[model samples]
Target: MENLAKKVRSKKLSTRVDLTAMVSVSFLLIIFFMVTIELAKPKAMVLDSPDHGCCDCPSYPDYGENRSITVMLDENDKLIYYMGLLESPIIAPKEIKYGKDGIRRELLKRKNSLLKYSSKSLKPESIIVIIKPSKKSNYGNLVDILDEMKIAEIETYAVVPEFTPEETKLLAAN
Candidate 1:
């Protein structure tokens, strides 16, 4: 009878598992994941966009059309750019490809030209890029153009949504 009692006690002892180590490990794992997730938050790019809603917003007309260029984005990655005002352009609206040899080259060329002109004329003048994205154009194209602007170190640029009748017709015809 005593042997039987001892055997039953042994079985009860075996059944009782020590869960203290498992609990501590689980809590440590939970804490580790929490800390990792908190540290892994995504970083964002800072863009200083103009406040269009303000009535007293500054205009760039004083900068002169000579210092300005307009880039129109269309479907299928088509980029049309014109120097100066559309009414009196230094360079007429023409399709240009993207990348180092395309828009970047043009931007650099124009920037260098403006620098030379400014040095000779003794005036404050810099390249102003006006970006106009058509409805058919994708967000990726706009982002790409913005990236190009940053790559070219452009200081003044705007993303204007409105398009003139002539501009719309020009885009449609192209």
Candidate 2:
């Protein structure tokens, strides 16, 4: 019998790994998160005031004293408010606290009264607020009062920095 020779064979294994799919998946995840995220934006408040002696300034109609409310901001977070003219005010100037129960309540009450009165007549009317911040009053106080005006929804308002002599005395006394 002839001797049979068996041939020995060696097997080769792959040394490389497929990383293209993994890289593609990682990039897809990164892109998805970037597209879905939202960036922060700056917030701003709208201020409406009359232009100072501008030749092309639009003329605004004069508002009545009956529909006016003057608010004075003092130091130590004290607030004073009055209605109509200071000389002959429909509502006398008085110190009031700040917040929903304080200035806001007073504003709403006066606004409703004026609305009722105007409703009887044929002309449309709204409350006009005059914000006067005293020298001793801080900027935060001014911001708070402005916020109150917004809360009370008094559309027509002005920020008058200068104070009258009587107003100065009134604030000094308070």
Candidate 3:
């Protein structure tokens, strides 16, 4: 034990690793990537507006009789739909439940009618639907309506901000 103690000498060894160069190289790599990386371009959904943005453009009649279906989204997930013009004597706003027997059925019925009444050359895209989401409606309501439109296989549908005052009154009355 005494010979081993005599043979042992106390000496300090530096175990510190200098990470300054490593950190500097890592920061340089990070900065290089940050500077060279290209920013991703955001994709947006294109929405069609009613106004053409040109005053000189010839204006069509209030209702073109293009055989459009007006789907009015009311509060509490209620759907009020009318065919053709809103004021047409034959067409009145009818509240229907949402499902197989709901808006999809109505749209299918209208689509079949359109196929029957319209020229044989006309395509399914000719069946236009105007979705009007009231102020009381929310994002989920709009999404549901859009989903229903897709489920019904409607190709041409426009989202309108508001409905006419008379339509509002009709919705309230119902």
Quantify all predictions' global Cα lDDT against the true fold. Answer: 0.90, 0.87, 0.78
RMSD of 3: 7.9
Give residue 67's lDDT in candidate 1 (0 to 100): 87
TM-scores for the candidates: 0.76, 0.70, 0.66
What's the CA RMSD for each of the models? 4.6, 6.5, 7.9
Model 3, span 1-174: residue lDDT tens: 889878967798989999999999999999888866744456455665666756576543433444688888888888888877877724677888777889899888888787776556543325778999999978788888888888988877899886788888888897
Point out the higher-scoring one by TM-score: 1 or 3.
1
Candidate 1 TM-score, true structure as reference: 0.76
Q: Give lDDT: candidate 3, residue 148.
A: 85
Q: Can you write out model 2's per-residue Cα lDDT over 1-174, one digit (the tens) per residue?
A: 233455555688889999999999999999878866733345567777787877697554758899899999988998999999989999999999999999999999988988998887776688989999888889889888888888989888899999999988888887
By TM-score, the better pick of 2 and 3 is 2
Off by over 4 Å in 2: 1-44, 52-62
> Which portions of model 3 miss their true places by more than 4 Å?
1-10, 14-66, 119-125
Ranking by TM-score: 1, 2, 3
Candidate 2 TM-score to native: 0.70
* Candidate with more favorable, higher TM-score: 1 or 2: 1
